[model samples]
Target: MNSSMDLLQNYIQSFGYDWLSNVLLITTGSFFLWVIWRLIYGRLEALADRTQLAWDDLVIKAVKAPISMLIWVWPATVSVGLVLATHSNDDVVWLGKIDLILVISTFIWISLRLISNVEAHVLDQKKRDETTVQAIAKVARLFFVTIGILTIMQALGLSLSGLLTFGGVGGLIVGLAAKDLLSNFFGGMMIYFDRPFKVGDWIRSPDRSIEGTVERIGWRMTIIRTFDKRPLYVPNSVFSNIVVENPSRMLNRRIYEKIGLRYDDGDKIDAIVDEVKAMLEQHKDIDATQTLMVNFDAFGPSSLNFFVYTFTKTVNWARYHEVKQDVLLKIMAIIKKHGADIAYPTQTLKVDPIAMARDAEQPVGIVER
Candidate 1:
């Protein structure tokens, strides 16, 4: 091996082709790097596929491009450095700077890809909403990319303090001018973290009279589709200030009704209450976990009043209405079977016929009583 190395060195020196030797060296190094990357990455990929954790797959995927860049770009940079070595040591120094820039750029690329992959994995797992995931990933990419740019600038020997000062001054000015936009941006961030509501959720704010399904949550505004199918674009800042009710989070749909029984059939009020309570308790749609109240709550002027309060196990509007209808019909059946009737509003007035006749006679003759 020693003799072979000596012979090869002599051949290169004799031909004055030192650059060719460096090219050969770069090629050999790149080939080994490529082989190692393939072996390691292939095993990791197989292992990731076997695991239930999707993030490992994302990690493997995110690593691939950076390794590939190193395998390809690093050797090229080294070859460039070798070629420049003969020109001037100063030229080789500049090559090192270029290599530094390339390395930072590659790092930024990997960072962005990692963010995207991990966010996508989380979205697939539904740990957060698509809107929140996308927003967070965008922010992460911007942050890392900014860092990479600053790093490249530092490597290029630019003064960071001056640039930062100028940027700060400009940012202050822009921030003052676009305060509303900044508010909306921060409001969107709040939604991401606080998670008051999500896309496809039904939300209503009583104070704002805003009720709709969330269609999209954007950087500046949230798009809501009303029941009439109109799209309502609301600023993200509005959600921060308003009291939003998320009915989608409710475990059950409520049913509240007041039934009036006739005064004469009040004897069946206790039986009616018992029947209604039994009906609610045995109803297939009623949620047994919550409080069920059926009692004769009040006595109206014209009738006996009872209140039925319960919750349905389902929150679907159509199904809830169906369940409500069934319970109501059953209540009516129980009332009818118990020989009681639902009361209606009525009024009566007492009149004195004798006094009316006397007044009529006196008004016609006014002279004598």
Candidate 2:
């Protein structure tokens, strides 16, 4: 290596243009680095694809660009230092700091890329909770980035103690200025820890006009896709105060209905109720272990009312509706089988006998042309 360096130095002196020689050497070195990286990265990528472990693929992908940057950085820094040496050693010192910052940035980039790749891989697996994985990835990126910035600050000869003091005071001022933003951020943290709902969960707030599927949860806001297909951007802080019901987590969907029969068929109520209860208990979709009720509930003004309250085994919205329809149809069939019909509102008029007799006598032959 020393002989090679001497030969190159001799060649530069022979040209009597060391600056140009240095630039050419740096350019050539960068080109060779790129070529070397391409060859090595291609093989690694092929190997990663062949391996059963998915982590290797993520690692290879994450390091591809950062590795290339790092390989070029060292040589460039060395060349810059050599050039700076001819001018002044004091100028050469900045090269080390710059080199350190570049190195830190490269690693930070690698860390962030790896986090993203891991998040995607886990989501593709479909076994892990996507919200939790995304939250973890965000946290990991934040941690690595903060650490990288602190390291770079230290390398730049900043005073950690004084900087921390200033940061504390500045943080208080910033917090007060961006209180809502901070609240939303903390609210997001609360969601991550408490976990009342997650991505793809159907949630609704009683106190707010929020009813939708949660698409994403970010630091300041959450994205909800409403049933009408509109995107709702809700501040995370709102979740702190509102009551959110996550129907997605329900174990069973309720089927509640009031079936009214004509008052003339009141006597058949007992048999109809018995048959409905038996049908519910035998129905495969109905969760009989849950609260199931089929009985005479009330006497309406026009009919005898019976309520069928039960739960279905599925929590899926579409599937629950299907089960509910089947149960209702079966109930109607049972009612029809018992010769009872569904009731509608009807009104009967009763007139006094004297008034009816007087009206019948006056309307016989009066005619106005």
Candidate 3:
């Protein structure tokens, strides 16, 4: 072994240049490292694919990039270290610092990769809505990134206490400057955790014009696709401050309308009310589980008013509309068939003949001309 080392050293020195040695060493190390990486990665990938646990795939993918990078990095690091061994001054200290920084950077990269994979895996397993899952994953990544950066800074010989002292004051100034932005950011966080509504849910603000299916929930704002196919961007803080109605959560859609029939049809009002109730009860699309009211509710000047109050079995907007139309048509048919007319507003006034004659007998109170 000693003789072989002597032969290689002699061959390298035979080149008459010191840098040639380093170049050769790095080239040979990098070549062999790449070969080893290929073999290891291939084996691991096959094993991952064969396993039933899907997390293994994510784990394998997460490491593949870092490990590939490490292959090149390790060889380069070793070669640099060998070269630096020839120097014994401040250069050594500088090289050591660079090496430490590289190590810290590599760790941060690997940690971030793993965090991303774990976040994705957990969200997929939970089957969370797309927008909410994205928000959650971003928050998770941001948190890990913050911690990782701090760790790297500490590894670079930064004093954590000093940084904290400085950052506290700077952070306060930044917070005040970005007050509304921070409110929106926290509002997004609250929405992610509270889950008032999610992607694909139809939501509306009672006080605002924002009404639509949720398309995206980001850190600052949420994108809602409106009924007319317009996209509405609403600030996250708005949601925190307002009352939102999620009609998608409703079990049934309501139908409430008043029908008026002529006063001449008053005799048929009872029969009409009974028949309407029977019709509602027999309708398949009407929700029997909810309230149903069909009664003569009021007397108008020209008509007897009856209200049809019921809930459809479906929550679909178009389906509810169709059901309502069918119900109204049936009611009209019942009214016509029963010799009762649905009335429109009309006014009539008649003065008595005796009152007119008495008024004529008495002198009209009018201005003399």
Per lDDT, the best of the predicted structures is: 2
Q: Candidate 3: give the clashing pairs.
A: none
Model 2 local distance difference test score:
0.88
Ten-residue stretch with the least lDDT total in model 3: 1-10
Tens digits of lDDT, candidate 1, 1-369:
224333443454455567877678668878998999999999999999999987788878987988787778766766665565556666345656776787788888888889988887788887666767777787898899889989999888899999899999999999999999999988988987888888889999998969999988888898999999999999998888889999989899999999999999988899989988998999889987799999998889888999999999999989999999999999999999999999999777898999888888885546775
Candidate ordering by lDDT (highest first)? 2, 1, 3
Q: Which 10 consecutive positions of candidate 1 have the poorest summed lDDT?
A: 1-10
Please give the RMSD to the true structure for each candidate, in Å: 7.7, 3.8, 5.9
* Candidate 3 segments exceeding 4 Å error: 1-17, 77-92, 114-126, 129-132, 345-369
Q: Please give the clash total of every predicted structure, in order.
A: 0, 0, 0
Writing each residue's lDDT as its tens digit, candidate 3 over 42-108 gives 9999999998998788877877777777667645655554455445332434444555556666666
Winner on TM-score (2 vs 3): 2
Rank candidates by TM-score, best first: 2, 3, 1
Model 2 over residues 223-269: C-alpha lDDT tens digits? 99999999999999999999998988999999999999999998999
Report every candidate's CA lDDT: 0.84, 0.88, 0.82
**Global CA lDDT computed for model 1:** 0.84
The collision pairs in model 2 are none
